[model samples]
Target: MGVWGFLKTQFVVHLLIGFVFVISGLIINFLQLCTLPLWGANKQLYRRINCRLSYSLWSQLVMLLEWWSGTQCTLFTDQETVDHFGKEHVIIILNHNFEIDFLCGWTMCERFGVLGSSKVLAKKELLMVPLIGWTWYFLEIVFCKRKWEEDRDTVIQGLQNLRDYPEYMWFLLYCEGTRFTETKHKISMEVADKKGLARLKYHLLPRTRGFTTAVQCLRGTVSAVYDVTLNFRENKNPSLLGILYGKKYEADMCVRRFPLEEIPLDEKEAADWLHKLYQEKDALQERYFQEGTFPGPQILPPPPAMDSPKLPILGHPPPLTSNLVCNWYLRQRLPPLLILSFLGFMWTASFAVRRLIGVTEIERGSSYGNSEVKKRD
Candidate 1:
């Protein structure tokens, strides 16, 4: 590696980056908190301001993943879906596997113009996290305790609150409800066996209550449900550490859009639909492992006997749209502030409380919503 490349990997440099990320995030969170007073007076205006604030904070992480780390995010869908990406409100069903998957999703959201306004059904505990979690408060994030009985009412109402949101939004749902792990996978398949649902090789059983409820609450407002399957190229599972050190990794996401009307309103049918979707997701993962791409024919060299014709390569997949994302992020203003404000004692802006494991991304190895987490419910 050259001088610049070597610098990117240094711990001191990473600490500098982390310092900027943490401090700027807190400043943005403070701004988001300031918007709370506008809630009753002008709710729409409050939401708009909070969205931008949220973007300011979240996009810092996206910056690390896109520019600072130079990660490539390749999307596989048709032009039609691409055209509609930032145009309409969508509920994104993202598979939970890699630790940085949400960062990748946010990178896409940043490119599509919805990064600030993006939403997710996060667990209740994240609300206490300093920057990201606190920002979620004003962003109107839906939080659940994972108890069906206790969460049903509150989660539905939270979803209903977004019916008239001012900006086009993308709400992400991790239906598996947690990160995938070996022990959880075994238990999830056992639950699937009992429920007679199809066993999934690469995912935990998707918990459907949250997904169906979100659809029911946001029916008229949301235009489509984006079924997204994410995997890293070469199956190299990625981490925030890789991003912190500016390591380059390629991510492939297969997105299939389903019109909102197609999802049945009846709760039972919707649950079944989510289950069926997971089955198809399983097949997609299987295909990705078998072939290096999603459910599509591979581009290959011609047979020796008939070498005249060959398939053309798609635009250099080397680092497709993320460069565009990085460029757009370049246009933003706060990142320059991140550079100038790096000299302060950053411990006050520290991500962890120093007493416990703090922040969601930091706790990727912890079983946040797994079966053990279920016992708390």
Candidate 2:
């Protein structure tokens, strides 16, 4: 292997790069937390400052992925719509199959100068995820429980909060509450069958409540819906580790902007709107399978600001099961396990406290009864 390629293959190098990015991100996020008190005194100024700080932190991670990992992200949006991407507020509806899709969306947001202020209706579980979730909280990312009964009001309020955000932002909604899996795909198809709509081979059934609430809340604030259809060229299971390990893959993202006027205003109509949107996206995917492309004018977004010239092109190495295991252990299990443990401890303590209080109350009652009997004697 060439010297450049040899260096890329070194596990320690990737580890150090990842560690540095994560640590720096934590520090930046901490600084952002320090600005919370300022919001009460000067909301807009605090928001503007927080925006730049957020971009700095997120851009570092994006650079690590895009520049260090040598992952190239190309945007195929039209110039007219692309130019206005960061200039105004818009609702972004993205497919939620790939883990890195959100990262890719963030990269696009940065290129368009809106990464700091971008928002999404993400799974409530993500709110418990470290760094990413903590940052999302400050960035005003709307979280949903995926249960309409619990999520309805809070989600609407979250969307309403975006009405006067200081900077331009792209509010993303997956519509499909979870990642696409075979089981989910089968169930979604069943739902589609029941609805009498053609089944989609590539996606899961989208929960429409969140999408409808988003449209209703963002009605006047958002100008258009950027229906993004993303497909990987090689149809392999894409993971963050795979992308980090110099896995060369191509992605075709088709962005179609539909005016707000085209979407219906009522809740049921809004739900129908998302169903139709997915149907069209499914058709787009079918075209991709048949003809290998989305039939629309392609606009390549400018190379990301952090793209470096001295990048090494390293082909896929033997699967680093060790690194993969470590990442899986840390990223997937550790955080939630820690949170669950904390909650468990809290619950136990709460129960114990209640028991103690009950005992104390019984003793106090016994003492009072004895004193009353002595007084009667």
- Choose the strongest candidate by lDDT: 1
Write model 2 residue lDDT over 90-128, tens digit each, in one string: 988898777568777876886677777778887776676
lDDT of 1 by residue, 1-377 (tens): 88888998776665545555565566667777777789989999888877766665566676778777788888887767777887889999999888789988987887777877889999888887666678888788998888889998899889999999988899999999888888788878888899888999998899988888899999999999999999998989887766766689988889899999999989999999999999899999999999888864222211111211111210112222334433554576666577456334444333342221223343445564465547746
Residue 58 of model 2, lDDT score:
67
* lDDT values for all models: 0.75, 0.68
Judging by TM-score against the true structure, name the best candidate. Answer: 1
lDDT score for candidate 1 against the true structure: 0.75
- Give the residue spans of candidate 1 off by over 4 A: 296-344, 347-377
- TM-score against native, each model: 0.83, 0.77
Error of 2 at 334 (Å): 30
